[model samples]
Target: MRVKVEDLYFSYPGKDVLKGINLDLKETDIVCVLGPNGSGKSTLVKCIEGLQPPQSGNIIFDGTNSSKLSRIEIARLIGYVPQSSSQLFSASVFDTVMMGRKPHYSWRCSDDDIDIVADVLEQMGLANLSMNEYNCLSGGQQQRVLIARALAQQPELLLLDEPTSALDIAHQLEVMEIIHNSVHKRGIGVLMVIHDLNLASRYADKIIMMKDGIVFACGAPEEIFTKENIEEVYGVEANIFSHEGILSVIPVRRSDAKLVPESLGIF
Candidate 1:
């Protein structure tokens, strides 16, 4: 599924967040949104998932306007995995994942629904833990379970908010690889809000940098991860390098005093 956001504007009470944001998500693209804290990256994803409505703008998904679709209708098209895994219920892993079929289920779950949920659990490597309590699993395991839930929804578009934030490096790579494979093989469009620049550069087909609720830059990872762009948007100096076909970002730390050298010198 392709998503088009035109003239998007959103604000909370007494505060303006997203400002005239426009973006296009192509099918099978792994697009990552990067920004400093409080830059509205999460808000933009929420708007795309129809969890929060844009104050003024159009969210068109595969040519259908998002506003016209009900929550369940939208869920059928886009599945969201939020940053906080703790928001999940205390249900067993199987039941938690089975909930993803709510949009397709009538009051009762059919045999087909059970088969689909089982398939997703196996695909996500959670089949062995399917009977365990969801909250008792490790952080990475829980994250994968949540993703399995989203996958069982059979959505054409997947919106993830910092999916790898709490995982270790190994788990991060594992989860990202799973997402990459799913996008390539299943043809699902992925839009994720991520904080790690190198991860974004390495995994994302395209990068969108946000600053103060506006898109600062949008392009391929190579085009958007330059030192100048990184310093300007993230307020840090980063050395961007590529090996073979992989891109990497390394941040160079600066002393707080040196960061405002001119002001310090005057003092």
Candidate 2:
């Protein structure tokens, strides 16, 4: 699916959240949004999911304005996994995932819905926990279950907010690998907000760096993860390394000097 955000502006009474944001996501691209805390990463995803309305501008889903689509209509096209799983209603793993099929069912779930949910559970490695209480699972396990639920929805666009924040490196790789495979195999577009710069560099096809509720840069990981970009966006001086085509940053010290916009150059 092709999604476009044009001049999107959103705010609360006391503060602004998203400021004239513009983004482009094409079919099957894993786009990761990166920023420090309170940079509107979550708010931007929410606006695209239609969970929150932007004060101005528009979100175009495959050339259709998001405002024209109803809540159920948006849900049918976009599956959203919030930043915190606490916002989700807890149930047995199977039933919780089955809830994703609500958009496709009128009266009740069908055999197809059952099959889809089962397949997704297997894919997410949660088949063994199908009957387990969702709330009883560890944080990583709960995150996997939530992702399985979203996959069961069979949406064209997947919006994830820090889906791997709670997981260890192993679980993070597992979840991101699953999502990467799913995106390419199913030709789905994913917009994810992630904090780990190394993980984002390794998995995301495109990286968007935002600061102070504004997008500071957007490009491939190599272009976006330069020493200057890191110092400017994160306020840290870092040693950036590249190994086997993956870029990783080791923060050595705090950078009190702000990098001048023109002084910073991309490699």
Candidate 3:
């Protein structure tokens, strides 16, 4: 799926969130949105998924306005993995993943749905836990399962928010590798919001650096991950260098006395 976000703006009654955001997501592209907490990363993903409409601007899906697509239509084109979910009951892991197949099936799930779900479970190292209670898993395990579900959807594009926030270093690398391979091998477009600058730098074909609910920079990782950009976006000074053939970032200290606002937490 190809998506164009044009002049997107979102806000609450008292404060603005996304400020005239614009970007392009193309097939076979891995685009990562990078920002501190309160920069509207999550909000931008939600708006793109049409879960919440932008107060202004348009999200065009393959040249069609998001408003013209139904929820089911959107689901067929975009697989969304949110930051977290509040499950009211202990649904089985297999069933949780199967839920992503809803848009593809009508009276009942097809054999393809079952196979896809099973494959994603195996890829995510959760095949053994297919029958386990989802709520009983640890935070990292649950995050993996959520990602598995999104993969099972078999959508053209995947939108993820903080996909590796709960995992240890090993699992984080594993997940990033899986998503990277998914896009490169099959022309699946992925737009993910992540905080780890090095991971984004290494995997993303394009990087979007956001702050104060607006995009401060959009370019390739090497161009967007400059020392000045990091200091401006996160209020921190950092060392940027090439390490072992990979771009590396090491934060040195707070850049200034100005602290990121606590009130922007909800945005």
Candidate 2 residues 1-267, lDDT tens each?
899999999998999988899988888899999999999999999899988889999999999999999888998999998765763566899998998999889888989999999999988889899999988899888888888888889999999999999899898998899889999888899999999998999999999999988899999999999889999998888998999989998888668644445456421
lDDT per residue (tens digit) for residues 203-258 in model 1? 99999999999999999998998888888887777777888887898877542336
Expressed as tens digits, the lDDT of each residue in 36-73 for candidate 3 is: 99999999999999988899999998899998999999
TM-score of each: 0.94, 0.93, 0.92
Which sections of candidate 1 miss by over 4 Å? 87-89, 254-267
Give lDDT: candidate 3, residue 16.
97
The parts of candidate 3 lying over 4 Å away from their true place are 257-267
Q: What residue pairs clash in candidate 1, if any at all?
A: none
Candidate 3 all-Cα RMSD: 3.9
Of models 2 and 3, which has the larger TM-score? 2
Which is superior by lDDT, 1 or 3? Answer: 1
Give the lowest summed-lDDT range of ten residues in model 3: 258-267
Candidate 2 error regions (>4 Å):
87-90, 257-267
Per-prediction CA RMSD (Å): 2.9, 5.2, 3.9
Candidate 3 local lDDT, residue 262 = 55
lDDT (Cα, 0-100) at 254 in candidate 1: 41
Report lDDT (Cα) of residue 241, candidate 1.
81
The 0-to-1 C-alpha lDDT of every candidate, in the order given, reads 0.90, 0.90, 0.88
